[model samples]
Target chain A: MAQPHDRGPDFLERFVALLEGDDVFCVATVIRSDKPGMPAGSKAIFLRGGGVEEFGFGDPARTLRSQADRALDEGRPRIIALPEGVEVFLEVQRPPARLLICGAGHIALPLSRYAADAGFRVTVLDDRPEYASAARFPDADVVAEDFIPALHALAPRLFRHIVVITRGHAHDLDCLGEVLHWTTDYVGQIGSRRRLAFIKEELARRGFPADALRHRLYGPIGLDIGAESPEEIALAIAAELVCVRRLGAAHAFSLRGRSRAEAP
Target chain B: MTDLALARRLLQLRRDGLRVCLATVVEAAGSTPRDVGAKMLLCGDGATFGTIGGGCGEAVVRSAALRMLASGQGPGLVAVDLTQGPGERDGDVCGGRMRIFVDPG
Candidate 1:
């Protein structure tokens, strides 16, 4: 529903509020147009859950809504054609990708740093106070104790990437049990091949769909970079995270054989 | 900088009851310096924060933004075609087009 101009906050005010809440929204600006009434720069704001909040030009509310929805679905900006030779740039504004590290161990330290530098809002979780302390993870946005409780407390929809690097195999299994069901964009688990296979078999026996687990889980995680040290392993995981973030799981193919010049 | 930083600056300016205009590059074509969604905030006192792109293009947008603030006009758009000749100015030789939406608050 369109908000009345006389009452409530103006467009800018509402826009700022959405930004403060880290809500997903789109700003459709009429960047190029041949018409006079709807000249260039005319704009409209559309929220993901809400309809169009404000529109400067004439009534093309339905078109703007669909365009905004498309931008949100595509997760990228694009020029959309409107009525009367008007073209708008639908700029999608999404919150930064959040990284939820299930364990605040040695790998978590450098992984959190690399993920933060790569623009992911990093949240480190561990039951140990000494490990999850703010002093230990100075760069992490959130350092929470109590792994399972903390996982439950977070709105699963907010976290797009999840990393399970607990100190033990049992902890990794427990973390995966809850994380696999969450609405996450990517899930990576650090372990040896034998441990990962054992966990997968255990999860499969426990009614977790084997197909979904195979599709969603990135076990023995990170690219096959042959990384040994904690720092190198963190780099490998970060690289894999970036690959999945940008190219999606299906497009994440091995670049071993392809020429470096031709590889993206 | 991030868009949140720009939004916070704009919000602070609004709270202070200062007349200001926000110019955002909603569309960028070809090889522009900045990507789409880049922003620049211009206050009535001629103070500027953030940047759409440095040099001639920003100067043009800033001048138009000042005019919008002075005239008390509503939001308007400014299209900067930097695909012009080489003798124009620094940072204007990127051979690109940018559509800046200037909104007053």
Candidate 2:
């Protein structure tokens, strides 16, 4: 039986909605194979069970659903090769992750613009009301509150890529101390080499494992772009954000003086 | 284009009751213009959404998709071989083979 691809809310709408929202879903697409059952473009979306709402869609094959389940569980996209050259591309997709700008400094304005344009849900946080006003950041959500309280509010849910570009070194250290505990992939700070080294030493003394700080935190953040102006620095940080989001565990080290981010 | 944009376009097509075939590069081996997951939509009225590495190769894929749409058949795979000798003349040779999944969807 041939069925039209439902572009209505029944199928594509839900797919787009899920993509725009927070729920993580896996879309399993049959790429190629000698398998006679499914055509090449046949696809199915599987949502995680238990509290994650699973809506209408004629039930998919158990095997296909389980494969998608595995993909969702692993949180990685992979090509599943069945016996006899059946190739299926299982894409684990979610909405663009939220980028937390810890300080609403000069860099924060351009950073928010660049990050939002690059498909990040940017949130600008600062204790200063003047700086954290929504007018300053049209593209980002502004939170006029102290750093730790706001971070605490955001600590529960994942998908946080924090940039600690506070006005002063002391505030930067304070923000770093709070966010270093989270298991997020990115926690970048802007400072000179000596300032960063001092902050790292302080963090180490404060009982954050030295290796974890070294690995998780990107001190003197931004790729080696020799950025001078605030806008250029913001662009570099935005590039680093994409680098960490896309190239996980590959460029997963301190990005200070690292390779320039490739333009998309 | 992002999948969201494609979905929005698809929804518009659905509203307009316009038929279309969606072509996706399911697999690409060796040097190819577009990699896997690249997509293009060929509407009934000879309009296109996005590009599958725009060239003669895309034109061929578009023709195949139109054929599939006319036939009212389900999704099918189009094996595009770009490894032809220079004299055969697409002029743009990438020496790669791409399997495009064309769905009259």
Candidate 3:
């Protein structure tokens, strides 16, 4: 293994701070190599907001930076083969993907737990302080405020997954109206087709292209997992969240799209 | 532990001025229990932080890491072949090869 720069706690502290932010980055480590001049233990950290930082990569730092960018874009890690059979492991270090639950109600409880367990920093939001109490969502952050303002203040772009499951159609519509403007991996709303239809019509009136956002939207939220109870529904939502996070939105099976199928 | 947590612990150890031997599975081929980039930190007096898949393979890597930690020894790689001929013991059969890089991080 080639020698790396003396990376102490300062390096880690900065990296952790980045994790807490909305920026995506990459950390490429030269883990195995036979190529001469390629330092086996060197690292190339590509901070998107900042600039590139190389630690003992010496001559091959340039190539590592390119690879890091590609890995960051893909939101995945890969072993890049360099000259003379040297392989560097490039790990995409994006800001922790988060879930924003618009209404902290029955489904939010188990959904928060499941999402947190699945590595999403969850934030449960509601106007009712009692429902949005921190104790209610032990594994998630809680915000007690009106849905739209809370969404705006929290910055919907920071949350990759947004689930709107408010107590009524009005709140859901307001939340979705705010969220559709942001580019998120998953934006779901829990409601019947009629309710969502009204919301979409209202959104179209409010200047958002409802059809344009359809590809990224998951209405009547969650995977078609035959869920009945609140916990099962939360599990379905969490499963959909994982699907969108890992396998991409193309493979996600939303109930809204499969409403024709009868319940099992 | 999560990779981030392990990284934090490694940084803490380095902050304390302790040189720790970190073993990372850089490459794995066929039926390996652990994938590439899996890491295990070997602290002083034989405290192992994580695992690149436990059992005999990890032990072999640990031994190589101990050798790398010796005074004047530089960072090096360890090759472990979990593959064996047919009729090999069932409990030990994973049938893969791993290249582990051990460095003083």
**All candidates in order of DockQ, best leading:** 2, 1, 3
The clash numbers for all candidates, in the given order, read: 0, 0, 0
**Per-residue alpha-carbon lDDT of candidate 1 for residues A85-188, written as tens digits (9 for 90 to 100):** 88777888878788888888889989988887776778888888888888988867565666777778888988878999989878887888888888777788
User: What TM-score would candidate 3 get against the native?
Assistant: 0.72
Worst lDDT window (10 residues) for model 2 chain B? B1-10
| Estimated TM-score for each candidate | 0.69, 0.71, 0.72
Ordering by lDDT: 1, 3, 2
Candidate 3 per-residue C-alpha lDDT over A145-192 given as tens digits, one digit per residue, 9 for 90 to 100: 888777779765677789999999888878877887888899987876
Residue pairs with colliding backbones in model 3 are none
Who is ahead in DockQ, 2 or 3?
Answer: 2
Q: What is the lDDT of candidate 2?
A: 0.75
Model 2 alpha-carbon miss at residue A166, Å: 2.4
TM-score, prediction 1: 0.69
User: Can you write out model 2's per-residue Cα lDDT over B2-95, one digit (the tens) per residue?
Assistant: 5656777877897789888878776788889987767788987789997788887798888887887788877777888888877875654888
**How well does chain A score by TM in each candidate?**
0.73, 0.72, 0.74
Each model's Cα RMSD:
5.8, 6.3, 5.4
